[model samples]
Target: MTDHGPQPVERQLPTEEARDLLALVRDLVQREIEPGAAEEEEAGRFPREVFRLLSASGLLALPYTEEFGGGDQPYEVYLQVLEELAAARLTVGLGVSVHTLACHALAGYGTKEQQAEHLPAMLGGGLLGAYCLSEPSSGSDAASLRTRATRDGDTWTIEGTKAWITHGGIADFYTVMARTGGEGAHGITAFLVPGDAPGLSAAPPERKMGMKGSPTAQLHFDGVQVPDARRIGDEGQGFAIALSALDSGRLGIAACAIGVAQAALDEAIAFTAGRRQFGRPIADFQGLRFMLADMATQIEAGRALYLAAARLRDAGLPFSKQAAMAKLFCTDAAMRVTVDAVQLLGGYGYTADFPAERYMREAKVLQIVEGTNQIQRMVIARHLAGAESR
Candidate 1:
């Protein structure tokens, strides 16, 4: 089957360096990512080497400070890079996002000593990280998480299960939130635990519907010990830190959704142009052309929305509402556009012979991850209406 990758997106970058960075990313994606994405995804193989290459190339460290082995790129540039990676394969793109999410607490709240000690290796030392907040019972209601962290002198022991962890079994480190005090949001504390910590084990990876190349699993912390030095921020600040990270992470999801939509639209366009109809090419039909137009428009709109939210974040402004809106609109748009791509391809789209089917399957998960679209709507509503009355 012919693979139609997305066309180069004309990006408006802030500097010549940013343009060069995007060019480098596009070249890397074409050479290292897009070519084998279908085969690897089909085989349920995780591309750890690709992530290592990204780390060595400094791609994984963008949006972080250069003092700590980071690229110091703005969020706008970082998000565009994510779009390019996600256009080729979502596993890689979303993996980078999760790694960034894992680093947020330390980068934003950890002390100077902690940052100097850990940020360098985490940002660019070819190490992967995972964020642990959601548990088996609490996902959308993250504040209700039941994982416990019992402190004794200089050490803390964690005991609980974290579900739907993106890099559960394979990560080099994990940023975990566990209950440390009372009930509710203020009770949680964040800890940076090494993956090899005793009593820390991961169950088998979850059999997911899509993004098979990425492993999602349940992580069990059975008396996993972390030193006091590994704690991030004051006790009872984990929930707030997680929420802050999520605002940025949602924008990453939004960018990735646009990438998937763009890929699906490209596939639909390529298929329609070549596949002949009763009298002429299917691309000549008015109905299909309109569908293609809508797909392109939605991709463009979604991209714009995510970039707008990213810019707000870069400016050090409040962007939680905008991030929620972007995640909601972009994922919904991706779902609609990918379904339309499959419809435009007809039976071939339903079969594994074409990538339209895979895109559709993958698109379904975007709306569900990084907080469900339903949850995103609630966030946006809360921003507009102010907090719901108890």
Candidate 2:
């Protein structure tokens, strides 16, 4: 495949170091990721080797502290790098996001001894991780999750199932939330369960509309035992930790959404500029030009929205409301822009020969993952109107 993806986006970096980091990311995406993205995704192949490369290059752990082998980049720079990766391929971009989410609980809340023991290996040791919260009976109302983790002498025994887990079967570790108290959100606790724990198993990956290369599956924990040392934060703190991670994770989704939309727009522009219709290039049509303009505008707005939220996070300011807004706007914009890209291509957009259709498909999951756009609206509303009555 030729290099026909979107050009590198213009970015405002906080430092010279950030600029160099973005340059390195663009080079990697061009040479390693973009070339085989469509073909590998079509074959349902996960790019484990590419992930290894990312791990080695320190791209996988950019936003964490450097004391534990992370790159120590701020969230602002980290999210832009994510946008660049996502533009090349959603699987790669989203995979990195999920991995970062998987690390959040322990990174944010783990005891100092725990961090010293486990954080370094996790950040750069090439060990993949998964976050487990939603169960078969619970998704949007995640606090109602039924997964149970019972304590015994020095160990916790985990039971029940986690649904829609990214990196389900292949992850080296899982950050799991299970009921350990009474009921609702406050009852949950988080644990770092080894993927190879006895009785831990995964079902076959979900057959999805897009992102076939990224596995999503259900994980079953039947009497899986974990040492108390692996527990992250205090008992009954898992829900809080999970929510904190989502605040950041939602921004990651927003960045990915813009990336996919940017890619689709690039493809649409390239096609219209070359293909002739009614004895002239279709790009010359006024109607088509307006559509292209709208698509570009939406992509830019989404980028700005996500970056604004990321900057708030970097400054250690309250950003939950803005995070929800960014997630809501950016993902919805992605869906609209990708759809328009498909329409601009007419029949070819529906076909597999062009990437617009694939972009459309990939854009859909962004609206659903992290939290659905509907859920984001509720979060923003809560921030504005206060919590709703039961």
Candidate 3:
């Protein structure tokens, strides 16, 4: 099958600059990301250089203030860029999202001095970051995280393991949430720890079914000392900080899901148009035509859903409920659309020669990451009906 890259998506960008930004992203994806994505992913090679290029181009900082080297674009624009990148290669797109999440604490709650000291490099410099919240015992029940931080004069010693950390071993810094008081959520506190700190180490990356190009591993913070200055937000506020960051991160995952779905639909369209059966192109078959129609419709709907949530966030409204709904819908849509794409390709879809199978494998993880679809349902329900009983 011919690799057509991602088809140009018709988007209603808010400004000429945003339009130009999308064009640039498309150009970059076509030239740099799409060609080697399959081979590199098969080899499990992380595209650190692509990330560095994105940092230099200011794509990594699009939603932050320009005062600290960010692009200052709205979430709506940044998400479209993420969609384009994800359509080309999911690892790069998701990595960008996680990096943005790692920076959220400092950008949103750090004092001016903290912002001045760290925001510039994190936003546009060639530094990578990881978010450490989930633990082996915690996962969706993040309020029960066991990582602990003990105070000692001007230093706080962190001791615990953080599981499922994206960019785990390779990040330049880590935004760590450690418990500083009693059990449950309020005990947690956020801290910024350098990657090469004395006792910080990472276990080997997990062998995953997809997105192998992105490493997911456990991070060990063994009495890793961080200065009091590195603490983010008020004490006992880490859980709140983490949840706020996740509200936005879920939207990133939603955009990525749509990107994957669009890629699959485009591939299916091309395959059905070119593949002939029963002495004619299969595109003439009404059944396959209807399938294609359904795939296209789902992709469009998922795109619209995510964009609506992003606009709500951009408008400074409470978007937590909308974000959860978008993540749940878009990821489920991606799973269905990818599965259909595979079925449409018939035997070819199951083979490594075609990308349908890979897309399917990658789509499974989207439903699980950021938050599980089950967790998303709970979040949405909580917003609608009120929090669940203890």
Candidate 4:
């Protein structure tokens, strides 16, 4: 099951159990999340009830092990679930991806005791999670972070500001990265900082271009105390943990991008077919039909890229390059497809009359977050050169 590039195969759909799960998820997403999504975005409200619905349905923990009250699905399957959620609402999909990324360090790298204590609550609780890696001055260069973490006997004292923290004020736990050594990537380390920890607080949410329903705030750790046991791995392993987690996180975002594109395409198809203009259905026009075909083609290619990367991950291979490729290609594809979708709808698309406007706004953030597309290209270039040299 190795894929060399973006050629998608028409393989069999999901099996019985997987299909049933997908159907259940599709229904839940459409019924529970889609209806209020626009209103929520307009009102700048988080979907607490929808989060509870997903948590209860086991979608929140879909990729985790079943041993700790999770759905125990593979990335290939879990990504589709995310795609469905994103199609319904971009905020829910991004929130889920951020939370899952937050859990990666603890679940995969934590000691058995740590996993036993923290994963269950994170996988299936009312509590949310946030990955605290990006800082005010250090985003793309994550290793250059300045947050200080000094060892204080059995506990660690952490003091720093974590910027662009999703679920910043609302999450139950934050996977925080701080400078534990000297200047450079090696000095950084990851620590599980509880939201309720003393000396820890969040600033008010930042006004953003989009994804308003998903809050983003800066977190302040003023002499925050952490147990030595909360460190994800050895002192310098924080970068490794964060990178590994993002390898999976990028795939999640790619899937969400596909969903965004799919949603836009679906809206376009419906709009064009029903929208009568010049005494004929707009979809009947050859020019408009060509654009629709291109949108669908790009989406199919994006799915193939992510799925190939997912298979590589499931097979325990080096997939950083593939992950980056998927994120970069799919996100850019979403941006183009969604914008064209809006263009196809004309005046209605510009206003709130269609979902394509929101879809376009949501598409912009995907390119910026989870390592900018520029960052993705750098990663891919390194991997390509590294491979060619080898």
Prediction RMSDs, each to the true structure? 1.0, 1.2, 1.0, 4.9
lDDT of model 2 at residue 277? Answer: 88
Alpha carbon lDDT of each predicted model: 0.93, 0.93, 0.94, 0.88
Candidate 2 lDDT, 246-316, residue by residue in tens: 99999999999999999999999988988898999999999999999999999899889988999999999
TM-score (C-alpha, index-matched) for candidate 4: 0.95
Judging by lDDT, tell me the better candidate of 2 and 4.
2
Per-residue lDDT tens digits of candidate 4, residues 1-390? 111111222333456777778878777865788777788998999987788778877888988899887787878888887887888898999889988999899989999899999888889986689999999999998989989999978899999898999898988899998889988878888899888999999999999988999999999999999999999899988988899999999999999999888888888888888889999999999999999999999999999999899888878898999999999999999999999999999998898867889899999999999999999999999888886652
Q: For model 3, how does the per-residue alpha-carbon lDDT over 1-390 read when each residue is reduced to its tens digit?
A: 756555788999999999999989988898899999988988999999999999999999999999999999999999999999988899999999999999999999999999999999999889999999999999999999999999999999999999999999999999999999999899999999998999999999999999999999999988899999999998899999999999999999999999999999989988988899999999899999999999899889988999999999999999999999999999999999999999999999999898888899999999999899999999888888865532
Between candidates 1 and 4, the lDDT winner: 1
All candidates in order of lDDT, best leading:
3, 1, 2, 4
- What value of lDDT does candidate 3 attain over all alpha carbons? 0.94
TM-score of 2: 0.98
Q: In model 1, what lDDT does residue 188 have?
A: 97
Candidates 3 and 4, the one with greater lDDT:
3
